[model samples]
Target: MPTEILMPALSPTMEEGTLAKWLVKEGDEVNSGDLLAEIETDKATMEFEAVDEGTIGKILVAEGSEAVKVNTPIALLLEEGESADVMDNDAEGTQTTSDPDPQPKEQDGSGDGKASPVTESDTPAPAAPRDDKGERIFASPLARRIAAEKGLDLAQITGSGPHGRIVKADVVDAKAADAPAPAAAPEPSADKAPAAAPAGPSADAVAAMYQGRDYEEMKLDGMRKTIAARLTEAKQTVPHFYLRRDIRLDALMKFRSQLNKQLEERGVKLSVNDFIIKACALALQSVPDANAVWAGDRILKLKPSDVAVAVAIEGGLFTPVLRDADMKSLSALSTEMKDLAGRARDRKLSPEEYQGGTFAISNLGMFGIENFDAVINPPHGAILAVGAGVKKPVVGTDGELTMATVMSVTLSVDHRVIDGALGAQLLEQIVQNLENPMVMLA
Candidate 1:
């Protein structure tokens, strides 16, 4: 007996998907748990897997075809000597009787038995060449699906993304394949001449011709809807202010270098961000008001110092909650943070991983960013942005001025929840804790 490979439901928000690329070819040996295809859903490109092992016999759905429903028979796997006859008998809204020999129709042709448009293009225009080597592409799933359904070639599109990667809006507004450029309409004829073909069709007629496609509106997945609601509420409701301070980090850098060298045998590689997280946690203890949330008609102060650290993911971003940060060791926080971030990018995080916090941190320093203000993670009075530490000059005691490593930290605060004094006091603690790692250990 042969096994069928169904189109997978890649994400909770995904009702339909486009076959981005097939990992296995027809007649290829497939193993259970092997990645089968890359599926483009509404949110992101996800890998679909095979659960049953066998020889892959056919590719039922072509790549770049859109709106393929979940569980649709997408491919088939066969035992030795098994035929691809099962699909042949049931294809194109037809079925055969038990005794009838099924004939398989070749699916190599387009609607009119013509070659596919993908292969027909000899060369793209100079200004619109497609990315043959799509190394840094970033198209949204919805856009890819829409492009596929309409046969709009993505390669021919000049991507408007930062690095020229094709994005969703580019596909939606793409003109039809081989569509003539919109020409200026000829003027209507005078009494001496015949009336010209109604100039540019009336506006209503043009609009009707280009009406949007019919689509079934689906409910947002738990993750997407939650992201939207939270970000919107945070931006609209929170009264945010920022305070920036630069720390001379010559000691901290030397300290980290020495600590890592000594602990190299101990297997703990402490990142600067890890030190910052620990510092913030300890700082929250001394100025507890900074580690609190603002609720309707009351302020809910928290203990134990729960911190939400922002993690950027494929679809928007989420924060992983590091519970009782003030109580955890630097190594423990480092380990947990790595686990939470790994699971977050893989979309395997539970609600608890993202929810609840007294303070938050977003670090773009490793990416070489010098300064940025972060949006407050809700319920948390402040979110901290950590920048790259650089070499600078600082005045030291004993009337000595010297070059030192320095880092800039920015705190975005919700004014209603935390006053300027409390915010400043907490910042001082954070600075001190980072400067002296031994203090954070206590």
Candidate 2:
């Protein structure tokens, strides 16, 4: 039988993506782990790999196709001794090529009446699990892993994913029933439905408001759309509070100058932002209680100091994380950050490279922005908004006025994860590290 190769979800939040290019054509023989296509997701452009060895029977979706939904059949794979005729018969009279709709009839979201076309094989292709009645169970790989770990039966649980496939949310919700239920709210009456949050205005409505004005309407890309949705959700749902502090950077500037001179021959010049990253990473270790993220029902406190640094790209931004940043030296941190930022601008980073961090740093100091509050990225406990350094007059220890380099910073915190006191302590630790730059090496 011919197997359908579906469009993959490159990232967790990706529902659809642009099929930028295809490496294999019809009748091309592809082995497992071979590069198949380049998929442009909301975050980056990633290469898709073939999971099974087969001959490409047909290419359903064309290159440069945008807004193609995940799991929609993009190509057809023929097994050994199989020909193109098998695809038409196996797909139940569906067109083998040039058909915009390539999804099989069984996966039309009408419930699991028949088995999925993707069957189990020795290779690492997407395999369909079977129920007790021998009916095929459509589920994601992550969902299946979670179900196995929890000792749950797939047949007993209902799927709410695309095309009725089981996803991680469905598995987690199914496991919740085994535990004690929380307090329930009163159900709404039949006539009185719950009110939805206002989504500002429709495109038509907004255009009407600007009828007389001359403006070019730009379409939102995947990156822009994701940024708008996630930030909107973060502002509305997360209970955010701001904490501000001013740190004297005289000692840090002196230390940085000395280190740069010594490291000049090695081609390593550390920036103020590099010092800030090290300071924050060390601060998380010093105030471990503040290093956490808000799970739905609980909080997850992480042990390592994984820090995400925001890098602005052409359309949007990417926050590539530096794992175990506290263990790295300033020179190493500078090099890694430069590489991450460069790749981020080129949209070549993988999903794992830009995700999973307890905290983030958004530094607009280079642009000469004095100070501004930053929005907290979801699942992160906080984000530090750093401002430019300026010369300011301050009182010396002997009560004499002296000039020193000062930088302003604001910590946007999720109250659910870190309290006011804990956030303050974390900020204090950061300020201390910056003021006493030599202590960071110790």
Candidate 3:
């Protein structure tokens, strides 16, 4: 029997991705766990693996194809001794185009009416846990695992997945609905209307406005489109509030100078941003109430400080997180941040390296920006925008004027998660940690 090789979802939010490269070709004999292709998601390029051993019968989707939706058949695999006649008939009956419509596969002469893994039915009949004979249940591997963990019986649940395959979501919904008290923890539901901004004018219509004007049209890539969509949603849905503060950085500068000299032999030169990362991490711990993220319906307060630092790249930017930053020394943070930033610029980072941070830091200080507000990334409670440190006249303890290095910072808080008072307290702790560098060491 021939099996359909569908496009695998590389990330949780991945709907479509680019088929960057195909490592296998038609008639190539492949075994389970073999690498078949390289899938380029929005964040990273990940290798796609084969789950069942078979011979590559055909390459349905070509390499370099972009926006290939998840679960779209990319190729076909045939078991040993299976004839190409089985595949030729299948391909002839199906349409092959940029938007291929999923069609069912021919039955393999098995008396059972259950469809094979290669066959896809868009509007499949609901899957029963057991057949008429009361044999073992037919379910997806992920579905079985989730059902076991949730203590739910697969035989009692109906599947809505492709070809009536029991999927992870089916089991999760069943378990949640069957729980003792459903209202206590309501399952997250999708909004009836998408939160996306209304569609803009057609490309031709927009071009008409600039006709006779000098302008070069630049097409947007995957990275640019993703950035646009995400930022738009953040501004429209997330209620954001700004908290401003100014901290004297004279002490941090002097301390950083001394530390850099000691770490010079180890090739670890610390930067002001490194100290900022450490300060933010410790502040999260000092004010644990602020160490939280908006988890759809609930707030998740984390014990470890995973701090994401924004690094600008060619297309857009990447926010690679440093896990447990509060527990690491200044030199360690400097070394780790440099490595992450280098890989990020080269587009070599994996999804895990750049995802899931409770908070983030974006410093345009090195660019000489005085002060600016940063948009809060979704699911994150807040983002710290740090500005350049400049010398300014200040009143001393004895009421005398003196010059000190002052850095302006703006904390962008998600009003849904952090209140105005709580945001102020969090900013105060960050400033206190930066003003007294020795306390961070302690």
Candidate 4:
């Protein structure tokens, strides 16, 4: 029997991907763990690997195909003794043996997991499942139907299948739990029931308004679409508050120059952003209560300072995370940030490189922007938006006016995770670290 090689869900959030390129063609003999294809997900391009040794019997999906759903059969594999002819009847009926779901492999340094390639098996899993909030849940169709028939909630079942997907065997003999009584629907009233949100104008309606005008209509790519959807959800669901602060950067600037001169021999140059990252990392430690993310039901306080920095690319942006940033030297942080940003621009970063962080930094100082509030990336307690450093007059401690280099920053905090006072403390600590640059080294 010919086995169907289904498209894999590389990242936990990936529902579909573009088959960017195929490394193996039909009739090629491949071993387990061999590179099979390049898949372009919403975040980055990743290489898919083979899980079992077999001869490629047929290619079902071609390279450069867009929006290919996960778990769809993309190729066929034949055992040593079998030939391509074995797929003739199977291909006609769209029936073939499929690989069991693959277990998630721990990504290096990235606490998040990535699913491995599937292996030859008897049953096929359905497309990835989703809950009401649109998060992906893995399960087979048979298991779903059985659970529905038994009046059991699939989310409660412990999946024994690969990647922890619920399967028929896991749910067949399970007893249904008691369902909670439904709540009464609230009546719409002027004083009690809230009004529904107004819907946005449709494409046709907007197009009609510009019927006589000439304009270019650009199509949205996967990256752009994901950004739009995620940010929209963030603004709508997350309770956000802002905290603004201004810091004197003259001391930091002088200290940076002195350090750069010594580090010049090692071919290392530190940017102001590097110092900002270190400042935020230390601030998270100083105000440990602010180092947290909002889970659905509770807050997850993280022990390490993992900071994500935004890097703009051709069509979208990537926030590559610097893990354990609080412990790294300034020079090391600079080097790692450069490498991550470079790879991020090239779209070569793995999912783990850009996934988890309790805090993020979005710096537009180089572009000469002066203080702007950034949207809070969900699950992160706060994001710091940095503006340019410019010379400004200020009163010195001795009541004398003097000119100093000042930089403006706004910390967008998630109120659900950090209160206003806690956010202020975090920002104050960051300001203290930046104003007294020598203290950071201590």
| Model 2: CA > 4 A from native | 89-127, 130-198
**Could you tell me the C-alpha RMSD of candidate 3 in Å?**
8.1
lDDT of 4 by residue, 1-442 (tens): 5655767877756666788999999999987568999999888898887655678988878889887666656787776787767556443444322322332221111112234443353233323344545444555445654665676666567877555766666778988867531222122123321112224897789899999999999887778878887787788889989999999999999999999999999999999999999999999999999999999899999999999999999999999999999999999999999999999988999989999999999999999999999998888989999999989999999999999999999999999999999999999999999999888898
RMSD of every prediction: 20.3, 8.9, 8.1, 9.4
**lDDT of all predictions:** 0.67, 0.80, 0.77, 0.78
Q: If scored against the real structure, what TM-score would every candidate get?
A: 0.52, 0.80, 0.80, 0.79
Clashes of 4: 0
For 337-430, candidate 3 gives per-residue lDDT tens digits of 9999999988879888989989999999999998999999888999999999999999988999999999999999999989999999999999
- Pairs of residues at least 3 apart in sequence or in different chains that clash in candidate 3: none
Least well predicted 10-residue stretch by lDDT in candidate 3 = 105-114
Clashing pairs in 1: 130-155
Q: Report the C-alpha lDDT of model 1 over 341-421, residue by residue, as the tens digit.
A: 887787667545677788999999888898898888677899999998888888877679888778899999999999888
Worst 10 residues of 1 by lDDT: 107-116
Rank the models by lDDT, top first. 2, 4, 3, 1
The TM-score between candidate 4 and the true structure equals 0.79
Q: Could you say which candidate leads in lDDT?
A: 2
- Candidate 3 ranges with C-alpha deviation above 4 Å: 103-200
